[model samples]
Target: MILIEDTVISDDVADKFFVCNLEKCKGACCVEGDLGAPLEASELPVLDEIFPKIKPYLTPEGIKAIEEKGCYEQDWEGDYVTPTIEGRECAYALYDERGVLKCGIEQAYNDGVVDFKKPISCHLYPIRITKYEHYHALNYDRWHICSPACDLGKNLGVPVYKFLKDPLIRAFGDDWYKQLEREIEEK
Candidate 1:
C-alpha cells in the first residue's frame, strides 16, 4: 500500500508564493475535532504507553470513533451529521462565542510547550500522501469541512492545509507539483 504524504502544503511551500494569516484561520482543522486516529500496529506500543496517562477520560465511544475511520466520502446521514462516537472530533476542539476555529496543537506550539509534536495524522489535514509505483503523490485534504477561518484562507490567500502538505516542491522544482497532481488523478 502506498501512502501519500504532504510536504509542500506548509507555509514553507505556500509562503514562497503567498502570506498566510494562520491566526486568522484559527486552525479550524483541529477545532472541527475528528482528531482521533486509529492506532496502527506499530503505534499500539506508543499508545499503550501513553494510554495510562490519558486513560482516565478515555471513553469507549472515543475508541469506536477511530475504528470508524470516517472520511470525506463516508456516508453522513443528514440531521446535522451522522451519529458518531466521541462526537467524531478532536479532543482539543473549542469555539469562542463568535464561533471561530481554535486548535490546541498550534497554541501549544506557539506557547513553546510543544513544537511539531502532534500526531502526523493530526498535523496533516486537508492534505495527505499516497504512494504509487516508486513515486509519491502529495495532495491536499479538501473535504469542504471547516470553519470560516479555513474558508477565508483557502479562498482569499495562500495557505497550505497541512504543515507538510507536500515535500517542498522547490526542492524538486515546479515539475514535482504537476507530477503529484497527476498521480492523484490517475489514482
Candidate 2:
C-alpha cells in the first residue's frame, strides 16, 4: 500500500487497469451487487434532496422502494446505502431502451436538476473506500463481470488510478490526487 496523506491506497490501483465497458458489462456493478451502492453519512441528505428530481427517471419499483424504505437503508454491515428494488437494482438506477443500467441522480445532474452527480461511491466505482479513525483505505474491487473492462483497460494502458481521476478527485481532493499522481510518477 502507498500512503498518501491520511489514506492508504492499494497497489492494484496503479498496477491494474480498468475501464468500464458498458456494452459488455451492461452496468452489472450497479445491478449485481449484494447491496446497493454504499453511501457516506453526509450523502443521505443529498439523496433525500435529489429524490424528487430523479423520481420521474426511476422505475415504478424503484420509486416504491424509495417511498417505503426511504432514500437510503442500512446494510447488515451497518453501512448506509441506496435503497434497492426488490433487493436487486439500485433505487436510483434507470435503464435506457437498450436495457443498459443508468443512474437517475446522475441523469438529473447532467440535466441540471441537481449539482451532485449521484453518490461518490458510485462515481468511484471498482474502488471501494473504507474509513478508519485515522485514515481511509482505497482498494480496487475485481469482479468476474468486469473482465471485459479489464481487457479494454489493458489494451488502452489506463490504470485504475488514472482511469478514475475525476472520481478520485471528487472523493479526496485536487491536492490529494495531484500528490497521488506525483507519487506514482516518482515510483
Candidate 3:
C-alpha cells in the first residue's frame, strides 16, 4: 500500500492497467452493478440541485425513476446512491445514439447546463474508495465486464493510475496525485 495524507492506495492502482473501452462494454458498469453509482454524503444536495438541469438529457424511464425515487436514495447498507431504474440500470443513465449507456448528468455538464459533473464515484470508477474512521482506502475494482478495458490498457501501455489521472486528481488533488506518482516511481 502507498500512503499519502489520509488515504491508503492499493498497489494494484499502480500495477494494474485499465482504460474504458465503451464500444466493447457499452457502459455495462452503469447497468450491471447490483446498485446504482455510490454517492458521497455531500453529493446528495448537489443531485437535488442539478436534477432539473440533467432531466432533459435523460430518458423517460430514467426521469420517472428519479422523480419517483428522488434524486438519490439510501442503499441496503444505508450509504447514499443514485436510484436505479426498476432496480436495473442507474436512473441517471441514458443511451447515446450508438446504444452505449452514458451519464445524463455528465451530458448536462458537457453542455454547460450544470456546473457539477457526475458523482465523484462515477468519475473515479474502477477505483472504489472505502472510508474508515481515520482514513480512506483506495482499491482497484476488477470486474469481468472491464476485460476490454484491461486489454486496451495493456495494448496502449497505460497503468490504472495513468489512465485515471484526471479523476484521481479530481478526487485527491493534483499534489496528492503527484505524490502517488512519485511513490509509484520509487517502487
Candidate 4:
C-alpha cells in the first residue's frame, strides 16, 4: 500500500493495467453490479438538482425507476447509491444505438446541460474507494467483465492510475495526483 495524504492506495492501482474497452464490455460494470452506482453524500443533492436537466438523456425505464425510487437509494450496506432499473442497470444508464450502456448524467454534461459529469464513484470506476474515519482506502476492482479492458491496457501500456488520471484528479485534487505519480515513479 502507498500512503498519500488521507488515502491508502493499493499497489494494484499502480501495477495493474486497465482502460475501459466499452465496445467489448458494453459497460457491463454499470449493469452487472448488484446495486446502482455508489454515490457520495454530497452528490445526493446534485442528483436532485440536476435531475430535470439530465432527464432528457435518460431512457423511459430509467426515468420510471428514478421517479419511483427517488434520485438515490440506500444499498444493503446503507450506502447511498443511484437507483437501478428493477435492480439491474443503473437508472441513470442508457443504451446507445450500438447497445452499449452509457451514463445519462455524463451525456447531459457533455451537451452542457449540467456541470456535474456523473458521480465521482462512476467516474473513477475500476477504482473503488472505501471511506473510513481517518482515511480512504483506494483499491483496484477486478471483474470478469473487464477482461478486454485489462488486455487493452496491457497492450497500451497504461496502468490503472494513468488510465484514470482525470478522475483521480477530480477525486483527490491535482497535487495529490502529482504526489501519487511521484511515489509510483520512485518505486
Each model's total of backbone clashes: 22, 0, 0, 0
Global lDDT scores for all candidate models: 0.41, 0.91, 0.94, 0.96
Order candidates by lDDT, high to low: 4, 3, 2, 1
Those runs of model 4 whose alpha carbons end farther than 4 Å from true positions after fitting are none
Which run of 10 residues does model 1 get worst, by summed lDDT? 71-80
Supply candidate 4's per-residue lDDT for 142: 95
Better of 2 and 3 by TM-score: 3
Q: Candidate 3 regions off by >4 Å?
A: none
Of 1 and 2, the candidate ranking higher by lDDT: 2
Tens digit of per-residue lDDT, candidate 1, span 1-187: 2223433232222332222334555544543444343222343344434433432332454334433542211233311121234554554333444665444334544556443333445444444555447665545544444444345565665455223334334234456556544544454
Candidate 4's residue-wise lDDT over 1-187, tens digit each?
8999999999999999999999999999999978898999999999999999999999999999999999999988899999999889999999999999999999999999999999999999999998999999999999999999999999999999999999999999999999999999999
Candidate 1: residue 161 Cα off by (Å): 6.7
Question: What lDDT does model 2 reach?
Answer: 0.91
Q: 119-145 in candidate 3: lDDT tens per residue?
A: 999999899999999999999999999
Candidate number that wins on lDDT, 1 or 3: 3
